[model samples]
Target: MPARPPERTAADLLTTFGAAPHQTPRQPPTSAKRGRVNRPTAPLRGHARPGHGWSPVLAPLPVYQASTREIGGLFPLLVASPMPAVGARIGYDVQSGGAFYCHPVEWVLRNGLATNPNIAMFGEPGRGKSSTVVAFALRMLNFGVRTLISGDVKGEYTPVVRALGATPIELGAGNHARVNALDLGPLTARWDTWTVRRQRDELSSVLGRWVQLLAALAESQRHPPSVSDEAALAAVLRRLVGASDGYTRLRPITIPDVHRELASPDPQLWRDLRYESRHDFLHQLRPMTDALANLISGALAGMFDAPTTVAIDWDAPVQSMDLSRLRSRGDTAVAVALTCLGAWSSLATGLRDDGDIRIVVRDECWRQLRLGPRAVAAIDAELRLSRLEKIIQILVLHKLSDLYSVGATGSQAVAIAKDLIALCSTRVLFGQSTRVADDLADALALTGPEHQRLTGPVNERRGRALWKTENHPAHLVQTVLSSFEKRLFDTNAQLRPTAGRGGGVGRSRG
Candidate 1:
């Protein structure tokens, strides 16, 4: 090895090549790290020297600053993913370009995305509010969730009900169908088998609902009942149901039966109500009695006074109560019919077997609120109980102002009606005029972008709506319906000239 040319070191080679060595010198390897490999160091940056490789210039990264609002627009999907396709596939998410699905119960119970299974839908006329609701109900049918249109004022749901192979129960002056406001429905079916405590609780609930219904009915006639009137009604309901006497069996009562009890002063009821005498009790509750009498004999005559004539097929995919006949009577008449149907439906759907979920649609629900605070209370109770009953109650309104119209400014009814907006965790807002859109934005705490989207020209198209589920970001959705669904949910058949000529629009089909 001819004097072993002093083995050249790595540093000597770097100096000979006119390249500077790394500033940090490598240390001798140790037995503990013998097999470890060293990572290469970054190349030095500077002007190139003779025989040295060129060092590329490095530029500083540009730091962009913008508000989240601006950034969200730039990267919408990155900001938030689309809502899971968990429920009924009603339409498409306009923002994320994904299919949109909604099942209020599933969203609340299974997904934990909502706190309640109630929804409030608002829209201007011809904006497809009704169509969207019908589409949701129809699609949810495939999920084994049934639907009940508590009060269909326009008979709009009739075609859907029939299409589902079930006849809708029609109620009005000339209609044969009857739904007693006091009918207990399925709630009291197992009363005898329940424990005493259960019976007492059930009785209290039954009486409370009856009294609330009676108060609303009385208010419809412009006679909002007094506190004493509610007490008398509760007492009478207890007596009629045999709950006051600790009886094992219960009795089913009708509106007329309640009216009869109120008309003929019951001595025991007067005593229970702490009245001095029958004459005093009769004189004090005169307005309530007169109101009940008017309901039995006036516009609502023969509609809700008799026993329930229509048998509800609980197992059916869908059921609707047609109240279009009363539309000719007046708004007030239709409202009273809605109040009665709401109460009847609440009782019918209250107690059901577990896993039996139903969607209850309250069309023109503002009319029910307009009755007075008591009526609003009745609706409020139903909304509150939705979670426990496994019911998804959908209230349809033409505008948010409809709720404010429930009573005078700052009135109790207005307060309750306004609070109704909070109870519904899901709110679907359709196309609105400039004024209505502004009010909706303020009421819902919608952002500037959300408000713009609501009144935007894009929302003007039919079936376009803004769906706000709880406190999550709102979704712009365009409801998609099949040709069959379009024909099935078309409510403008009467307005179309072709309909008069018996065109496909007017032709009845499932």
Candidate 2:
């Protein structure tokens, strides 16, 4: 398709609006107050591209007029009569003012599968990463926004569940809740949820990696262990197990665990494998039990299949997931707990009918998205729900490098997301200042003091930030803070890991 004509210039815009370019005198809505509205000099008066006139055919949608400049340095993609970001066009709102993102109408109407397909936020501790974003999602929800919160960190979202009156659907707790992986039971009541042909089609392709991985684990456990021993064992296991049963969340088969399982029942098979060196490696891999757990929970979250409608009782307070217990736990264990939380969040958001479901997939979420083997890929793809499913993921991660350590391959993490919110768009240099501010000022295509004014000041204060919009250079904006910021990741303070099943492990919970 041909491109739309070049966007209109400022002068062309002004002249098009006619003599009173600031006040076009549009018909005010019934809700409009006489003094509150800013009558633009004139309607958008720019000529269309070479082919058209008046209403620029190529222009994106618009936002509503605002009483005052609310938030700053955000893309005012959708425009409105003299309003940068007003009303539903609003995005972030701090005490100082409100900022607009895309027009709500456009958002409601558009496919939402644009270049930036996922929502993202990043900040150092205490910058209100989850808390602030939760409230933001709620505000959108109250206005009947369609979204879902697949929470990566559960504790950060309790405030959100409460503020929105969303019910707590905890596994092993709520009546409606079932403590199982992927919440798959609810996907289809009947046994044949998937067609026979579909299942068969997926068998050879989808189950390949999963079966191989499990087989490798079993092979590593043999006693005499020839170099080809483990491979031989894996071949045997693959011949016996089927995908449907093998891929079940309940069927956890880790590498070490596989060795342990093989060592039992079939003593000769275990002994013939000559697994001494591999056993030592297995012992060293003890700490990874938690990492395995994290992978499990993540894989599970990606498996939810249900009616996708959750009704909340406004009278009851929302219950947030308590991660207060995960502090002292091993880092990998912490990651696992978070995966459980994300699974729950995704499940909750996938089913809300009354409002948007804001699933905040933060912290180590890239782990699940990164693991691209068929089983895990299917999980991620399903949970990365489409518009038909009311789920909007707010992925939060610190340095982009962390995306590397995650289990999956390629740019699966970045490829899955839709939008990015670069917080405090700043730089560090002499005396703890940065050239990013200068670059931001220059990039708004600003030359004079105005750019300096917007990108000015580097404060140590929390909740205050700088950003840039399509129209101009980066600037500062104030926002509310979340409770967990500075308290969790950046600080030493931690939560004890939640108790796992079985009593043989720890003396007591931390």
Candidate 3:
């Protein structure tokens, strides 16, 4: 062991470290100390003392108590977590800064995020509404879901369809393709095997659709058929399909065939319609017959009056009807074409062997609404039955006012059109002018912040839309398109001469 080191005192340690030991002052007398008052020590270095000239007292802040709802208005970033990372990666959620995904069908079935898979989109032209739809459709193809544009009035979807390696069915003056409005499609393919009850239900559904289509066509001509006309039409359809006497199998029919039968109906037809005589039947259904004749010979002649000339490949990823050729014929011609094509597409899609999901894009659907209340009813039926059909119906329009324009105020057509908004579980609102804000706010039940978002400059940015699912927090989405998608979905080819050729990288934000 080493020799013990000497214990160091405080003074010895301080002196060894080159410092002097602190010294204490002499104590005062007890009498003197009693008279002297103790004072607070000087303030710490670099700190101001309260009540000193350098520091001023501050009043107490009122205790702030606010609900999360009120606080969210001030800080929009405090939003619920984004939707699960499923479906197509559309873009990013503006509020939460997370990737946004949207697949109406998946959202409904998988997560119960919505009550239905139907979506209604409203946006001004050139706001990337079509682009968003095309992007969604293109992405959905990866999931094995097909897309069907029943009627492309502007021919905007032609490139997309062709890009997907499918020829778009072109119908117009110069085009040779034709679609029969009354084609039963595959509705009766397995009729012989189905039970009698199933047959009855199938026939009733088929006949109901035909009646609705005929009524819509007649209404389009400004001569809405009466209840008797509809009854007569149903009787004629049942007879034409050979279901009048409870036949097991049904045959496909055409508009011309129906027109011919109505023009010269047999006694059984009138009797089945419950009319006393042929003359009474003929007089009572003259308006409907004339409407049919007009449809056969008018602008729609040779297009929808004969058998369908185009063969649709059900396995294809995309199928679109290019009605742009008829766009020159006027909105009425295009609307009439849409109504017929809608019915035909419903049947064609129903004929699929595999009950796979499909996205049915109804662009410019407002034109069909302008036809009449019956036409509106046809669309309403489609929306209501989308879930049952395993289809995601996307109805695109310019604005909510387009629905109001279906008829006069307080009219049945207008009411039906307005109800169309409620039928869709998801509503996508793109950029719109301030003029349409009130209608949008009312139609969508938008909150104050949502209304401001729509009317604000945020929406002015193309591809930026507010996606509102049923009772869910609205998602502000910025639809992002890849370089290839930009070229394929370019709808401004005519507007820009260099659009079709290799051009600058296209972003929907433009």
RMSD per model, one decimal: 12.3, 15.1, 15.3
Winner by TM-score: 1
- Listed per model in order, the count of residue pairs whose N, CA or C atoms clash below 3 Å is 0, 66, 0
lDDT of 1 by residue, 419-474 (tens): 89999999999998889999999999998888889889436579999999867778
lDDT of 2 at 11: 35
lDDT, candidate 3, 1-510, per-residue tens: 999999985446445544344535434434333544442223334247554432122112123334444444445676665476777889888777788888887778766788899999999888988899998988888888899998999887887787778888889977779898987777656777788898888788878988999899998888888888888888888888889767756877887788888889999788877888999878888888999999888888889878878877777788888898798788889999999999889877765668889999999998998888888899998888888889899999999888887778999889999889888999999998888977898878898888889988447578999999877878888999998788877777555544555664332211
What C-alpha lDDT, on a 0 to 100 scale, does residue 262 get in candidate 3?
88
Per-residue lDDT of 1-510 in model 2, one digit per residue for the tens?
999999984435544444313433444444344454454322486544563345433233233332223211123443332224422322342223546343223333444313222344434444444544444454454445543333323344444454444544432112243233223222223225556664444333323333333322222121122335334334334333334354332222223343344333244333444445546434433333233333334433222222223432323333344443344444433444444345444444444444543333353354433332321333344334543454444455433333333334454433333112222112111111335335434433545654444334323444444433333333344544344432222222234343565322211111
C-alpha lDDT of all candidate models, in order = 0.82, 0.37, 0.82
Model 2 residue runs over 4 Å out of place are: 1-116, 143-154, 163-183, 188-194, 198-320, 340-360, 363-390, 404-510
lDDT at residue 168 of model 3 (Cα atoms): 87
Q: Candidate 3, TM-score vs. the true structure?
A: 0.82
CA error at residue 257 for candidate 1, angstroms: 2.3
Candidate 3, position 195, lDDT: 88
Worst 10 residues of 2 by lDDT: 423-432
